[model samples]
Target: MSTSTAAAPVVADERVASKGPVAKLLGRPEIGALVGAIALFVFFAVVAPVFLQPSSIATVLYGASTIGIMAVGVSLLMIGGEFDLSTGVAVISSALTASLFSWYFSTNMWVGVVLALAVSLAIGFVNGWILIKTKLPSFIVTLATFLMLTGLNLGLTRLIGGSVSSPSTSTMDGFASAKAVFASSVNLAGVDVNITVFIWIALVAVASWILLRTRVGNWIFAVGGDANAARAVGVPVVRTKIGLFMGVGFCGWILGMHNLFAFATVQSGEGIGNEFLYIIAAVIGGCLLTGGYGSAVGGAIGAFIFGMANKGIVYAEWNPDWFKFFLGLMLLLATIVNLVVKKRAEAK
Candidate 1:
């Protein structure tokens, strides 16, 4: 048996009869991120008078929704001990594919969306399969993918659409319905909330359930924590990792659709550095660099922190150049804090 499985009962014994509430709370992967988020929110709200306004709230939610969608997937994959540097470019690729396909074929918009989904999932599978087969580091594998997708995004758009951006899909058949579902906003007591906010929230809920309640969740944690050991204990390590990558692809599809519908066009060269933002959010939200422990809710909280900081910087009248500085500072701080928390959790 794997070390984790062998020690499961001892941990359960501690859980049921030894560790108190304080220890339990300390063991939570998201606790540090949660605390940090609250602190960041308060700091921003106190300084930026408009930070708490309804419109500002909506803006934060919209921004968070974009990154949060990807953060959840990244967090899960991180828990599985891998990274996908191609995610940002992949989003653009998916969007471009959908827009161009729908326009060229004169088909229903949904057809293009489904095709995009298939393409994204296939890319994910290739990434996962190649990594497992070649025994390569995920960083190297995805870095190559990132570069390839970047070239493809620009090259394919020019070759097929004669521009750096795909043609507007706003007028395509079924676009209105797709927009209403993915990009529309609803008013709540005069405050407009983006539909993506709802989607992000639902995704968090579902991901949390999967992580905390399902057998697959345990498998994910096991594989990330120690793949060799997990395999020894009968975990399908390869399948788990591939599924995690595909989950990321699924989120990329969702975000791609939203981006295309929201702006009515997909830029071939868009989404270059945004992968860093998603990773930073996941890291800030409590996913460890070594993986094996993290939370979906933590990632959501991290995205919220990013959304708030992004707009809060503007609202506070800070120089735009400092945004990257702030993000990097947060990432470092969160990583240090997560390490300390992990130590505490493992301590008796």
Candidate 2:
């Protein structure tokens, strides 16, 4: 009897030992993001002495804020097992919405803001409705939406301004508040830091809260982990997914409003090709392409890395063309490492 009890205890210990490595790997998904950020910073700082300058750092933070905001939203949706390809066009459309309202109607800035957000949420619902109802892959559904919105953005900008290349915001009224929220700078330790940075910070805080502290965050994790199981357990998987899609659109709109207010002008084609960048940032932040796990903070860090590399290279007097090459390398490396780690974790 004593021998039988001893054997059972040993078996339990073996099971735990087998899971130890896997547990370690899954401890914190953001570990890779931290390591990548540090590694890149060290590499760039060593190779380019100007990489750590105060102004250079500020520029990196500012340039990354808009995309960082979008990436955070994408990370959330990815965590819930969905994707939004229309984010790029959504960004332009949101900005254009605000721009047109302010430009033509002399509408209240607040009204333009409301309209931009509402339009994005409406589009998100449409995307969700199509994907959930048809049981179609979100990738294909959003891709179609992406093309459609792109065409509309371009056509409407031309219709409004009579020219695509020089989209004008001069006629936009109540530009002051928009600038204060999106473009205006506050003196931070003697540095002129754009309000967009604050927006990024606020977004991170809110996203982290929603993802970590709220029940909705748990649903996001569960829905991504296993949608069928989540639904069986009473989770509203479709609604949750639709909400995430809307989050992406909202992020895009915020960025659009920021641009419209900051420059008081925007290219009709602006934000085109930017959707991929947001995805890249989210992936680098440790959001799995296949979904289930991600970090809002990781997304922010990823954005910082991209922003730093883009501006840091320029400040260091390096060829701007090298930026694309560097970005490609970063994405490839992150993907490879993430895959290896994911496989190892699953192996147990």
Candidate 3:
């Protein structure tokens, strides 16, 4: 050759490309939801002047916290690739368990609380166990659970409490203490913010940490991405999935307790369709129907969006009937945006 010297081969590392801050931001699962939340906030601020008031904001946050608390577990379960159609009824079931047991047994309210927890965890365990054994889609498994719990909630409440609602436990031992923990409010800058808001924030922080920092988090993502592949690689697919379901049950328990203490009674039919709301929040938060991609923070944002829309309509004095229509529209739009953002992130 000319100089009998060839330049050493130059190998390009495909994975070494540096992503700018904007690129990184666009890569986040919740970025789309964040943008949507901001736009919604501004839209409401323009149309509904009262929405910006501290009192109204507190109310909005309270509503969001209720949904967001459950969204935490729902988000994680989704990340692990499963669904629980019984979540709505499951919550009422837990509340009913505590109220009925305490009122009937004439025991400390705390006793029923502990028992309710056991029952809740048991329901989740059964759902998981059946799924693992039968290999049925989560939909069928939880739908069966949904129906069973629904019947039991109504039938048992009527059988024991002699009504469609649980008996009032407001006078029971520990009622005051339990209510303080679950339903009380904190005065923040003169606004009475519900205790649930703090609980919701704590849950999101903890869930986010698990998903981003821990081995279990990795297991969740791995199993959700490809259970067969993850299993081949030594991931405990069965355990992860089951744990996720149980996590959902735990969340239902917390919310159920809140409902019980906050109101002292729960309607057997109260939670009938709320499972869809939880699913909608998760989906709007960037979770995939096919699973393996989402965040707790995204779910919180989704819940915030729901809170805004739900109250924004009232503030703006629009027909309340239009809410479902707006909810559907937002869900469709958010899903599309999340998909587009994900595609772009992958391309980059």
- lDDT preference between candidates 1 and 3, better one: 3
Candidate-wise lDDT, in order: 0.89, 0.82, 0.92
Model 1: per-residue Cα lDDT at residue 11: 40
Mark the 10 consecutive residues where model 2 has the least summed lDDT.
10-19
Candidate 1: C-alpha lDDT: 0.89
TM-score of 1: 0.94
Error of model 1, residue 62, in angstroms: 1.1
Query: Can you give the TM-score per candidate against the true fold?
Result: 0.94, 0.89, 0.95
Writing each residue's lDDT as its tens digit, candidate 1 over 54-154 gives: 89989998999999999989899999999889999999999998999999889989999999999999888988999999999999999999999999999
- Put down candidate 2 lDDT per residue, 1-348, tens digits, no spaces: 344446675554432444456478565666566677889888878888887877677778998897898998999999998888888888888888877765667677668778988998888888988989998998999999999988887888788777773346544455676677777888889878888888998998899999999999999998888999999999999999988888888888788888877777777787778888899998988887777888898789889878977887887788999999999998888767666666766675
Which structure among the candidates has the greatest TM-score? 3
lDDT of 2: 0.82
Model 1 residue runs over 4 Å out of place are: 1-20
Angstrom error at residue 220, model 1? 0.3
The alpha-carbon RMSD values of the candidates against the true structure, listed in the order shown, are 5.1, 4.2, 4.2
User: Ranking by lDDT, best first?
Assistant: 3, 1, 2
The residue-by-residue lDDT of candidate 3 on 131-211, one tens digit each, is 999999999999999999999999999999999999889999999999998889999999999999999999999999999
Model 3 misplaced regions, further than 4 Å:
1-15
Candidate 2, position 256, lDDT: 82
